[model samples]
Target: MRENSCSEPRLRKSRLGSFSKVATTKPNSNATSENRVICIYTYDWTDVADVMRIRDELRKLGITSRIPYKSDEDTMIGKYRVRGDTRISKYYE
Candidate 1:
């Protein structure tokens, strides 16, 4: 008799689906104002990197920007946490 070895465990697939559908609210409209603030939602570290890249690009364009610290109450969306908030001049598109 030969002994068999398994390197990885098998994962069972769900009949319904791998993930449940999560209801998401539509994003708020971008309103123009003197000191406009845009909320950037980051699901993971990748999003944070994206925000940093955008910031660099904006800096090259000589655009003023800032990322303010957000409290738990202010940044919570359902179960996801908002990575950062981008504040910019009203003239920024």
Candidate 2:
């Protein structure tokens, strides 16, 4: 039982990574927290060339986009189901 508890976290982390790979970007546009995923909602309307362009913007800022496939889909603030990885990042967490 102790062994199972110790391993459960790692298993959940792996599964969660898979789930975040393809989904609507989440939360406020352009806002990022340690647990918060970056919401590049602008990419939804942006064309392919524009995506790389936007990626450049992020790279310039020093934040890597975790989920690449989410670069498009015109995700308005309300639009994204925001299934981004919800890794614990708060001080209390």
Candidate 3:
């Protein structure tokens, strides 16, 4: 049998602020090789503004982002998830 061509993405976490944890990974698709996946965690609505600010900043820098969604993980601070990708930022592969 041929070896599996798809590989699982590796995640690296870094603290963004007092209450934010940023997890990043190299995208699996060849079309997105220049971009890295970024997941930001927020505690609640109070923290959404911060996430929005970050998202806007990334957009200004030509990075792409997506709408926030509820996370299935119960252990997450507020169960809210904000995802984005940056072209210039460095993340572990």
Top-lDDT candidate index: 2
lDDT of 3 by residue, 1-93 (tens): 121111111112212222223334434332334543344444443465655654554454454545443332532433221233333222211
Per-residue CA lDDT of candidate 2, range 1-93, in tens?
Answer: 022232245336442121212123355453444353333333233355544554554454565545443423223333333456343221110
User: Which tens-of-lDDT digit does each residue in 23-73 have in candidate 1?
Assistant: 234343432334434332223323445445544543544556554423334
**Candidate order, TM-score descending:** 2, 3, 1
State the lDDT at 89 in candidate 2. 21
Clashes in model 1: which pairs? none
| TM-score for all models, in order of appearance | 0.28, 0.33, 0.30
Q: Alpha carbon lDDT of residue 20, candidate 1?
A: 22
- Error in Å for residue 36 of model 1: 1.8
How high is the CA lDDT of each candidate model? Answer: 0.33, 0.37, 0.35
Decreasing lDDT order of the candidates = 2, 3, 1
RMSD of each: 17.0, 16.4, 12.9
